[model samples]
Target: MQLHELEVENYRAVRRARLSFGHTTVLIGENDSGKSSLLEALVRVLDGGAAEEPPNFESFQFHRDPVKHEIVGPIRIRIVFREREAGEWAGEVYAPIHDLLLRAGEDCREVAFELRAQPEGEVVWRLKSGKRKTSDPEVLRWLREFTPAIHLRAGMLTGYGTETLPCAPGLCRTGETELDEKIAAIEVAAERLISKTSPNQESDLEAGFKATRELLQLVTLPRDRKAPNLARRVREILGKGIDLNSSQPTLPGSNTSSEKLGILLLIAALLRVARGAMAKEMEPIWIIEDPEAHLHPKSLASISYFLSDIRWQKIITTYSGAMVGSMPLSNVRRLTRRRGVVTEHRVDVTQLSGVELRRIGYHLGAHRGAACFARMWLLVEGESEMWMLPQLARLCGYEFGVEGIECVEFAQSGLAPMIRVAEQLGIGWHVLADGDKAGQTYIDTIRRTVATKDRQGRFTLLNEPDIEHCFYKHGYAKVYQEHARLGGKSTRDMDPRRVIQRAVQTLSKPDLALRVIEAVAADGSPGVPDVLQKMIRTCVKVARSQSK
Candidate 1:
């Protein structure tokens, strides 16, 4: 089964939010923006391992608001799953799910697994016919069969400093009662022989056996040193004689990126094994949080591609721009937190077809990749502003990176579609353009097609022809003159735009702008052009205001 949508209410930072899922969804957000909480909620509801202990108040309920004195809620998380139909197991295995069908929609069958926790700490699953307490064995079995989710959280691959060697052949295998019985008998016989021959070693052998009362603990390190789950897991791998590091066969401590990636890959491999055995019967849902942890940018790109190739549905959470840029923007879900409420927004890049995405990919080069991390977007007309805006912002006492504002060069393309993309992504955006005929025409089109009122302001323009004129209008003509010979051209008589264009012919616009900014910086009394100053102040204001 595939998760079609998720509805979470009064769950941690998310007071109320509904998120839809695709084959692959990447959750992008700032720290503590409820991305982890969302994944945790899914795990608690769907992962059978967590069903043993129902969530408590601290885990389920939202914090009470002191000012509002809000009433405690019955924290609820509902996951809608699409039933499998194409595979062979769809009939025998998933047929029972059809009986519990919540609906038969046009595209696919959907069933909701609703988990609700009361204020008194009682949790229940609302099944199709009626509510079932989470303690019910039947409910837990259903969750395992239908919604077996694999959660790969941060640090999952690390921190194994001490681990015991695998047990000898045919010993301490997980879930093998017959093999375990034979091993126990052999151990007893061996212990008796050792005790009779070497009395001094008898006590140590007995102590070792007593310390590990459980069979699964046979291949694990000391109890105090290993995590409980890892302790139980070592025996399973031990039975298979799979030495992770075959060369020198040492228990890894997760020092290298390759080792970390190997751990993630191992998990995916196990899930794939499970998926294949089931005849792709039940869709294996993979939830990976911060897969970029311990991975360099190149590694993250490879992982992103690897994840995209997985057959089942995947949900990944990340804080890295490279991670976001590497994936299809259509799969990106941006999470934002304001005050105490958290929400999710996804840009409708899905509206673009495959060919369209390819076209956009060409446009989204290195400079545009920066937009993945931007809190607000500043769409400029050409390469000059994309290069010059940051420097100009510094000159105006603001920092672009520090403020999380990214300037995108649209190459004089229409702003209407780009504005829609920003709106769908919940990014605060403003357009900067010249007041010429073309810029005016685009701005007028934007005013009609784009939602400017929601943005607080429409396009801000320089009344002069372009930024070069704005520089001349300000007192920067002398600064530009100092950098370029300008053929003794003065802004008073010559066309300042032509002088600026010619200067760029010798030196790139950004290089020339840098030279002027450096000269003005040395001068220490550089005038902030009206247009540049307005843009910087506006960026700062918008960044601050929307960030709140």
Candidate 2:
């Protein structure tokens, strides 16, 4: 089942927030923005292995608001699953929960569950339907097993070496008498082997036994590979096998044709978990944290595609623009935290209005992924500005990219629609527009219509005819002339400004921007123009503030 909505309150860093979920939700946020906390909260509420103990009073309680908040007893997390469509699990295993749903007046398809942390070091879990709530321990426990949720940590790959062997007889097999009988024999041998070799780590062996039992209860194991045999093989190979953790692959290495070791291992770990889930006929909800850990750009793309190929539902937390770029903007859920209270913001690009879609279609199509991942965005007037501003800012010693700021083009279609989207997505943004009459009119209209308080202060107008005109006025025409290779060019020409403007218009924005960068590198003479310098500084300040 897919999560339709999630509401979290009194949890770590989250005071109160209601969020919608997609089939594949990508959480993007800066450090300490509660992206990881959101994932942990999901695991805790769903009993998804991450919560070893219920949250305590000081650690997980949300006490940020002083005036309008009073209840501070339990940390609450609730999730509403979407009404089951065709193709969802409708087997006998789920029959008991169907009764609970019907008893609580819930539609047979939709289910809502809430989990709360008690002061007595235990969790209070309940199923809700309309005004009715059911706390039947057996039903709640069964639901937890029925809806399998697995969290794939960044360290899950290297940590697999510690995975203990299944110690219970027929732990991974169910409803197959013949296979179970064979597995029962193998289990005896495997347990004897583990007991001999890892006697000092008896808990690990016992935990493995418990894990096998739990797996058997949750999933219908296929007979292809019995758990006992797999466990025996793992134990036998423990010392004889090559330790995968000894020599991990790093980027810029000898093997350039394939993905790095870390990414490969990550993929393997995720696949192992997926295989186990699939064997049980369950569509698992996999929570992946920082899938880009130790991955190069190419590897990130490959791994992202590999993830999409899986049948399981995924909720990923990421800080990498490359990974975000590989997915649709609609899947992104931007998280933000202020004074220890977390909030979630999402805007589906496909759901935008027709007019807005037309206005920002080019913007979204080209830069949406980068913008979504950025801590702040600098929305500029056209492609030329977008291409030029970041390079220019770098020349002034204020690197936009280093500050997690992305430059995006509004393409002169205006900024109102794009600004609306930015606001909805909770992206901290600033605009750079021309000082020409049309640009001024557009900015003024946006300032009046866009109710966002900081929009006016954030906008940095060139105070000249346009960006190209500003370049000409700053004596950058000589550099442009040098790059464009204009025949019979003269800095003191009759109309060098017009000459440079015409040349910039003729060449591609990216090509011209590269020329400008080369020109700046070749000669540091005029340096950054004062007006552009001021704007870059302002943008850098805003970008840094948002990042912090």
Best by TM-score: 1
lDDT string for model 1 (261-375, tens) is 4333333223222321221244557776777665556546545554555566788887776667677777888878775577778866666556555645555533365576578
**For each candidate, C-alpha RMSD in Å?**
10.9, 10.0
lDDT of 2 at 25: 86
Evaluated against the true structure, the overall lDDT of model 2 is 0.60
lDDT of 2 by residue, 1-548 (tens): 77777787767666666777777888888787876666767765555332233324444354344565554556778888764564243556666556544432234356788877754556776787566677776665555555556667764443332253122112234345654454343344334433356354335334333333333332223333545433322222121222223332112221332333333334334434333323243445777777776555665664565566445467888877667766666777888887656778877665577667655644554546667767677887777777778888877877777787888777644567777678778877777778888778768867786677755457877778777667767766765666455576564664655666656666766777677666655655566678778877877787677655
Q: What is the lDDT of residue 393 in candidate 1?
A: 86
